[model samples]
Target: MDRTESKHVFVIGLDDFNLAELQTVRNADEYEFHGLVDYDTMVHPPSYPMDAILAEARETLANAPAVDAIIGHWDFPTTSMLPILRREWGLPTPSLESVLYCENKYWNRLAGQEAVPECTPAFQGLDPYSDDPVGDLNMAYPFWLKPSVAFSSYLGFRIDDEQQYLQAMATIRDNIHVFAEPFDNILQYSANRAALPDHGSGATCIAEGLISGRLCTLEGYVHKGEVVVYAIVDSLRASNNVSFFSYQYPSHLPVGVRNRMISYADTILRHIGMDQSPFNMEFFWDEATDRLWLLEINPRISKSHCPIFQIATGASHHEVAIDIALGRKPNFPRNEGRFPIAGKFMPRVFGDTVVTRVPSREGIETLQKQHPELVVHVAVNEGDRLSTLRAQDSYSYEIADIFIGADSESALHDKFRHIMEVLDFRFSDVVPTNYN
Candidate 1:
């Protein structure tokens, strides 16, 4: 195809430069890719300038060639940025209100109640900044508390007592507005802007009665109002089961269970009217009660699961996001890829600690040479404090992300265990004065 005939897609927050895995959909010969804005400036604290980001994106898109689609995998600002850019460029995208309906935890809960009340949990929105934060709760203790619009589980905590509630509330009160302010900026462009609450003010939090069961994600897209689900990945947690340890594709859940979850997601999407967008819905299936609880829904692909899908499904789900944005059906392979199963594992340390040793480039290269298929991404470096890392959950520090493929789940676990032993990260056993 000639260059003029090529379709160009601009990713709002292309955090990393690596597009090797995603290019499986099409190389430069078929489509041109453009990246605008860094992830840090858009999602982090002290610099979430939503208006500036939007202005900069407009400038980039105007200068670039005719753009065909806009896509993103990260949450908050990136997913939030897509609709605005799509509107400016006249590309296919869900309405800003539809995207907000999915990203705002509190609003999502409200919609879920009407759409799939059976799957929606008991939830209430609270103002953590109030003197009586606990008094605002319609639900009891032992519930999860998180910002209405935050990413990567940052500032998310489990509220079990008055002290824990107070502590989590303090952190939330101080930081919730980091994402909230920028989030509120995007709402102004929404058609249903008047119907929403002030979630971008850092005062609101969602407290829900804890729901327990096997957790999995339903990944799919809605195109021209039709919702189609393609994959389910089982989320395996470590330690107390509150923090994620690994994500395994080709979930062990029965076909019937998977279909039911998909059906439930389809109903919810239809109700919310999320059209021309890729989405991932997290759910918990309580085997004892045989019930499925809708945890949350994001208006983008789960970037964490992309590589595993590429390893097991022969293509990255990026294909779906891009194709749907370009007004085409995803042409993923029906046959499985190189691995029957694959896992993305987060090697986590439970307490605050200082890194004493990290795998050298030489060590990582050696391991890759020994096992050509293994992928190692070290998040921490020597002399760095684990607590200072960005986007960590409250309970633990993830030192690295490791991806591997195996013939079976057990084999995948075994390979991950061996890989951890090989990397051999050493940490100083020190207690932090500000431990959450």
Candidate 2:
């Protein structure tokens, strides 16, 4: 842990906020972190520019004194690109095929069905560009349709009828390339990717039987041959059940259900050959039927939950990712922090609107001072036009994110309400959304 012997780590799409998190990691002085690619350009950009990002990262790697680890917290192309970079450099990380098992929805479902059929949903792949996509699909109305390789619920839709299915397909065809092109680029790197189903490419979509219940996520990582799950977060949704409302740490689910999720996570991670990597797997427990369903598996830390984990635990889960990336065992913390509860609230305005007003930097600073355990990140500026919000779900636009820690759940919500009321946000030219 000497300063002179500190190792160098490269992070894809690194930003100021995450850099601050990395600094608080245990033994922070033992590593020197470098940003591999521009955050804005890498995430929700007009184009992925995969080649450009790889070339830029290579240039940085070549200049570094020594590369100890390569880590990233964002979704694809960050998650998809991690294995490729690590494999090329002989770094310790999951294989490309294993990472793809978690990224490709169809492939992940196949693995889930094999490993834990009880928790896996019935699904089938459908080529959105096919002459008879619906004809090939067997699911009835009220099923879910989405890209095989998507993030943040982009292009995800619940099909209640034929008209809705057609509309969703048209929209998918239009925007699918934004993710498909770059995702395919990474797919090509997989040695056995050709063996996958023809319709399992990034451009494809999956039809899933309607599965709903208590939504929760287990954040964990695999190292060497062992799988470890550290925390479970409950995902709350708005009334529409389309957009996420907030992510609260320390799930309130029954102990038995949480254990099944953990056991399934371990099974799936081992079956998919995931190792030396971090993952956050989501699950749904159907209370009515006393059934459990595997939602989706992501092959990396959920950056959205990092702050909440930090508030509930003493350190951020980034430490687990960093450690695993370095080919070392993770020294992660459990419920050892100040607060018994923490939550991340995503305040969304479900339409396109021009930003007329937002809280000033001074005002935010004052609020933070008043509430020590509070953190607010406003996503828009005063004069900014809200033409497109690519990082959000298809149904709504998340204008700001608020993270807070409190002794009780009610207090956590109380803080969020006070912040929303005090920090006024005004918009113009609003297009009201109808989540029907």
Clashes of each: 0, 0
Model 1 over residues 337-379: C-alpha lDDT tens digits?
A: 7888987898888887889999888998998887676778899
Off by over 4 Å in 2: 193-199, 334-336, 383-387, 429-436
Question: Model 1 reaches what TM-score against the true structure?
Answer: 0.94
lDDT of 1 at 394: 85
lDDT of 2 by residue, 220-339 (tens): 888878899988999998767878888998889999999988988888888888888889998999999889899999999999988887888978889999989988888777667779
Q: How close is candidate 2 to the true structure, as a TM-score?
A: 0.95
Q: Can you give the TM-score per candidate against the true fold?
A: 0.94, 0.95
- Locate the minimum summed-lDDT window of 10 residues in model 1: 427-436
For candidate 2, list the clashing residue pairs, or say none.
none
